[model samples]
Target: MRLLITNDDGVHAKGIHALCKELEKYHDIIIVAPDDQRSATSHSITIAKPLIVKEVELPDIKSKAYSVSGTPADCVRVATDQIIKDKVDMVVSGINIGYNLGTDILYSGTVSAAVEATLCSVPAIAVSTESSAEDYVYENAAKYIKKVIEVAVSNKLHEDIVLNVNVPPIKDEDIKGIKVCKIGKLQFHHYYKETGKEQENLVYKLEGERVVNHVEETDSYYVDNGYVTVTPLHYDLTNFNILKDVGKWF
Candidate 1:
């Protein structure tokens, strides 16, 4: 299979590198990633600026890698529309440094990249590692991702659904098991503090850490408890249950 891999963490990230190394064993891989970290840039495209693409070489991975001056979604779009052009069999995003779970998916570039691929009618998966430390066990995450990808390819998941996988930071031996779950309702409080006064205007910035999620069955909780969480996500954002009621209100 020909796989097109991308990430929001940029071309030089160890996560993507590890993923490419593991994936290259069984499939032909091509990587197109942001030139710099674009985390939380969800499905954004570079419209005003001219997007640039350049070929790059990594240490051990022998796949054809490209660096893009855009968000994760742009990389997938360009890789499918221009670079590979209908030759791609699958699209895999991330092996991200941090977890993207629950409501956080709205701000995640990792999930957006996979969503973009699914929109193009290709199967995709978004993989993330839940680690508080700056450096994570990317090799283990990559191995697990490779196994999941093999299963996905063999079983052929629904085209409209993308897998959002979050792995714990623990060693492989410490991991409990993988769980297929639904997206749980988890939220973080946003706090701001006044930084300075600029030009007679009060300037404030985000201050305070993310709040601890209270939900028990959430992906966040599973990761916190050393279990890999696999959530199947769809592209449609419609609230079908409220459609008729909303229409009446309008």
Candidate 2:
């Protein structure tokens, strides 16, 4: 399979490099990632400004790689439309530096890249690690991702879905197994702190402290308990059950 790989952690991130090294063994891989970190950029595309793309070489990987001066979604857009000549069989985002579970997916550039691929009518998978540490291990995550990719390639996945995978930061032996779960709702406790004041304008920075609430049998719960969580996600936000009731008012 010809795979287009991307991440929000930039082209030089170890997580992306580890994933490329593992996946390249079986599939032809092309990486188009941000030139700098673009985490939490969501599903935004660079339409107002011009994007800059440059070819880059990473050590120990023979696959073609490019560094994009834009968001994670931009990398996918440029790769599929311009950079890669072959048809992309699959789109895989991340092996991200941090977990994109629950509500975090709403603001995650890692998952957004995969979401963009699904919008383009392609099967996509978003892989993330459950930590923010700089030296988190990715060998186990890479192995798990390879299996997931194989399954996705061999089986017929739902047309309207994309897989969101979160691997815990545990040792290989500590990993219990994989869990196919639902998207959990996690409440993050955050606050805005005043950073500066320029003339009459005030600047504030938003800070997320921690997860205050997490539902059971969710991606977050499973990942926290030492299991890999795979949640099937889609772009449909319509409330079908309430549609008929709301239509009566009209």
Candidate 3:
């Protein structure tokens, strides 16, 4: 398969490098990622300003690479729409430095990059690590991702769906197994704290505390208990059940 690879953690991130190393052994891979970290930007594109793209040299891997001065979604949109000349079989987004599970994925640029691929009528898979924002265990996550890619390729996925994967940060042997599950909660309580004032205006930063997902078989619970999780996700936000109920009011 010819795979277009990307991540929210920037072009030089270890996670993306490790993923390309493992997968390039089997598939033709290309990297188009943000020049800097663009985490949590979600589905945003560079509409107002012109996006800058540059071909870059990635050490130790030979696959063609480019760096985009925009969000992760911008990388995919520009790459598919303008950059790569050949057809892409799939968009494999991330071995992201941090998890993008549950509700937090709505704010995740890694998952959103794959979502952008689906909008382009291409199949995609977004994978992430359960590691904290800065952890050095990406190769482990990358190894599992290669397997997931193999399975996904053998059995094609619908363009409307993306396989969202989250791997626990552990040695390969210690990982219990892969679990196919539903999305779960990332934060139980959410709030913001006033950090300081910027000149005359008050500045605030969003904060949240996580609560365990006691519900079994969710992505949260499985990863919390040492299992790698894969959840089928779609971009459609329509509330089908409420459609008919709200029709009577009109």
Candidate 4:
């Protein structure tokens, strides 16, 4: 199969490198990733400024690779529309350094890249690891990603949908199992706050930390508890239930 791979953590990230290594044996892979980390840049495109692309040299893989000076979403858009020109059969993003689950998906560039591919009518998967430990195991995550890709491609998983996968940080032996789940409601604990004085009528700096989640049976909960969470995401954001209520209000 022809595969297009991308990530939010930039081209030089170990996660993407490990993923490429594991996947190189099975598919014709093409990597187009951001030149720098754009972790929380959700579904954003570079429209105001010109985007640049540069070829990168990797040690083990013989895949075609390019680094783009844009967000993860931009990488997919450009790869499909400009670089490879719809030649890819599927899209996979990440093996991200940290998990993208529940509410975090709203801000995850890894999921956003896959979402962009799904919007372009391709099956996509976003893989992440729930690890903050410096010595966290990534090989398992890579291997799991390869398996997911194989299953997805062979089953011809819905083209207009993307899978958001979160792996536990523990060793492979410690993992309980994989769970197919729905996107559960999780809320952040904090909000952005300005840290520095305004400069030229603009806020100079902002910083914040996420608030702890309050819900159970969520992707966040599963990851926090050492289970791999697989949430299928769709491009449609419509709230069908609210349409009638909104119509009445209108």
Candidate 5:
């Protein structure tokens, strides 16, 4: 299969390269990623200005790669609509530095890239790792995705659905296998800090405290318990169940 690989952590990140190396061994790889980190960028696309894209080289990457001076979603948008010189079977995002799990994925550029692909009528997979540890275990994530792609491609995934995968950073032997689960409501504790520099006027930084999620049948819980979680996500935001009741109010 011909695959379009992209990520939010820029084209130079080790995670994307590791994924490309493993995937290129079996499928034709085409990488188009952000020029720099664009995490939590959501699904925003560049407009009213020219989107600058350039062909670049990644160390040990045999596939054709490009860097886009835009968000992760922009990379997918441009790649499918223009940058791609040929046909692509699927869009595979991430092997991201940190996981896009539960409610956190709503603000994740990594998942949004895959969401963009789905909007373009292409099947996509967004893979991420749970830990941002110094020893980032990416090879296992890549290899795991290989199997998923094989199954997904053979079965022909629905264009509206994206497979959101989150893997624990532990060794393969320690992994508790895969779990298909729901998206957990993982709420985070964060606050904006006021910088005390007289030279600068009101500079603040967002600092996070704790992320809480304990739902057993959800993505966060399964991943936290040593399992690789797979959640099938759709781009539709409509609350169909409430639509009928809302119409009655009129």
Candidate 6:
């Protein structure tokens, strides 16, 4: 299979490299990633200015890799539209350093890249880790990602769905296995702090409280309990169920 691999963690991140190493074994891989970390960038694309992309080499990567001066979604957009010659069988984003569970998906560049692929009518998967602990387990995540990709490709995933996977950062033996789950409505306690002043502009930094409550059968709950959670996502934003109720106001 031919796969386009990308991530928000930049071209040199260990996570992306780990992903390239693993997937390259059975698939022809093409990696197009940001020149620097673009975490929490969502589905943003570069438009105002010309995007700068350059081919680069990695220590142990066997795939063709490129570094782009743009967001994660930009990588996929450019790769699919211009870079690669043949039709890419699938798109895989991440092996992200931290979890993209629940509402985190709304702000995740990793997941957004995969979403961009799905929007382009390609099967995609976004993989993430639940912990930022010293023991960042890429091997374990890679194993599960391989299985997930195989299943997704075999079924030829529908255009409406993109798989969002979050793996617990535990030793392989300790993992509780995989769980097909729902996106939880988890909110982070965060605030914006003014860090600097530049002329008439104010520089603020958004910080999280690093705490959350879990709900059963949701992405957070499954990942918190050591299971790899897979949640199918789509681009539709309309709340169709409430259309009739809200229509009464008109």
lDDT of each: 0.87, 0.88, 0.89, 0.84, 0.89, 0.88
Clashes of 2: 0
Model 4 lDDT per residue over 20-98, tens place:
8888888889999999989889988999999999999877778889999999999999899999954678899998987
Pitting candidate 3 against candidate 6, the one with the higher lDDT is 3
TM-score of 6: 0.94
Candidate 2 local lDDT, 75-187, one digit each (tens): 98988899988788889899898888888699999999999888877789999996545443676788889999888767876545699999988887899999999988854
Candidate 1 TM-score, C-alpha based: 0.94
Candidate 1 collision pairs: none
lDDT of 6 by residue, 7-93 (tens): 998999888887888889988999999999999899999999889999999998878899999999999999998999899888999
lDDT of 1 by residue, 35-141 (tens): 99999899888999989999999998899999999999999988999999657888999989887877878889999999999998888999998644444478888
Worst 10 residues of 6 by lDDT: 130-139
| Candidate 3 residue spans exceeding 4 A from truth | 132-136, 198-200
**Which window of ten consecutive residues has the lowest lDDT sum in model 5?**
130-139
Query: What is model 2's C-alpha RMSD?
Result: 1.6
Candidate 4 global CA lDDT score: 0.84
After superposition, the stretches of candidate 6 with alpha carbons farther than 4 Å from their true spots are 131-136, 194-203
Candidate 3: 10-residue stretch with minimal lDDT: 130-139
Q: Candidates 2 and 6: which is better by TM-score?
A: 2
| TM-score of every candidate | 0.94, 0.94, 0.94, 0.90, 0.94, 0.94
Residue pairs clashing in model 2 are none
Clashes of 5: 0
